[model samples]
Target: MIAYSRSIRGIERTEAYARTHPVNRYAAYPLTAFEQTPIAGTQGNRKKKEEAASQGVYSWLREAGQGQKLLGELLEKLGRHNGVASKEQLENSVHTLVDAMNRWESAYQSREQLLRPEIWEAMTLAMRHPAMELLGIKRGGQEVGRRLVWDPAILPQNPNMEEVNTLRRVLLGSEGLLMDLKRALSYAEQYTPMQLLRQPFIHMYPYVLYYGAAQAYHPLPPRGLIMNKTV
Candidate 1:
């Protein structure tokens, strides 16, 4: 009976060890090829590639700083509630956020200003998603490029082009901004998760997906404007 109990405990310990093991996770988030190699200036051509890769890393770090700051602000707001939130106060708070969104979205359309905060917040949320494991898509050559790790299934199959177009219009259209704002506020009230901040891999996926999607979809800003790191 003692031997039988000891065997069961050994199995349990093995299982527990497997559950916390990071090998699988590290496999999922493999380091970039550039990260794998030492920068050798002997060849000279590789030096330029290394420099560009380092710049990309710095840009991602900056964006991460912005995301961390935004998340801290959100957490502070959540902490103040103390399990009691007044409807009027919540409405006013949401209104303020929506108003800011309005200004940024408008500026983006006109190419007058582009705001990175929304992108930062989106990155934060994507990284905190429970399934976040990988950070980048495999690219040819030595440099690694980040990619969003969402399942393609997250987007509906045969998504209605008309409805999708309408949604995009609602989000980007000035005339429809107020309606979209109201809907977003309502959704946030019901579904926003505050506990994501406590997750183990909260910081990893955001840097991957945010810059990955940006590089993939929007490689450059609007015509006639250079890159604006400030906005």
Candidate 2:
């Protein structure tokens, strides 16, 4: 009886160990290839890909799906909120947009782009969905503005009636000023997980069958872009 009990205990231990064992589960969120490396003891900013990937590990533990879904939904809502651009400005609109988008895109792609409180605010306005539908698609192939992450699937977050009404106009104006949506799309296509979410098992049969096993990453959004860093 004692031997029998000991055997049962060993079996339980093995099972428990298996359940608790670490596994390579990317189901939680998308990670760039650079983000796959392990973290260090310090939160050093020099090597960003490492920092983001490490931070990603912690972020997964605290409400993963809801926040990501919320972000997508909010983006979609913003899309619904954006007012149509009238093509009124003619020349000035394109010039103004190109300058601003270029500056922001440059900063975002650079290693120097640090997260400031003000940046969070800018992202709020910049991440609106209409930017994708209008600016991103129209100017996608330019240099790299807001095109990459502009999927129709990403839903918008719920906002007040008044805010929602104003959203479209605001986004259209912003979109008009930019050029280079393609650059952003290229990055997302190369790295982001959001790209993966839009297709295959989730998208439809033929579409999934088309890509087959050639898994790909989602493109990053134009305005609020995130990149992978090496630690």
* Candidate 1 residue-wise lDDT, 54-165, digit = tens: 4543444443344334434433453353201333433343344333443433333332122223433442333342222211111124331232222323333343656445
Q: After superposition, how far is residue 55 of candidate 2 from its true place, in Å?
A: 25
TM per candidate comes to 0.24, 0.22
C-alpha lDDT of residue 44 in model 1: 69
- Candidate 1 local Cα displacement, residue 27, angstroms: 41
Candidate 1's C-alpha runs over 4 A off are 1-44, 82-231
Q: Superposing all C-alpha atoms, what RMSD in Å does each candidate have to the true structure?
A: 25.8, 20.7
lDDT per model, in order?
0.36, 0.37
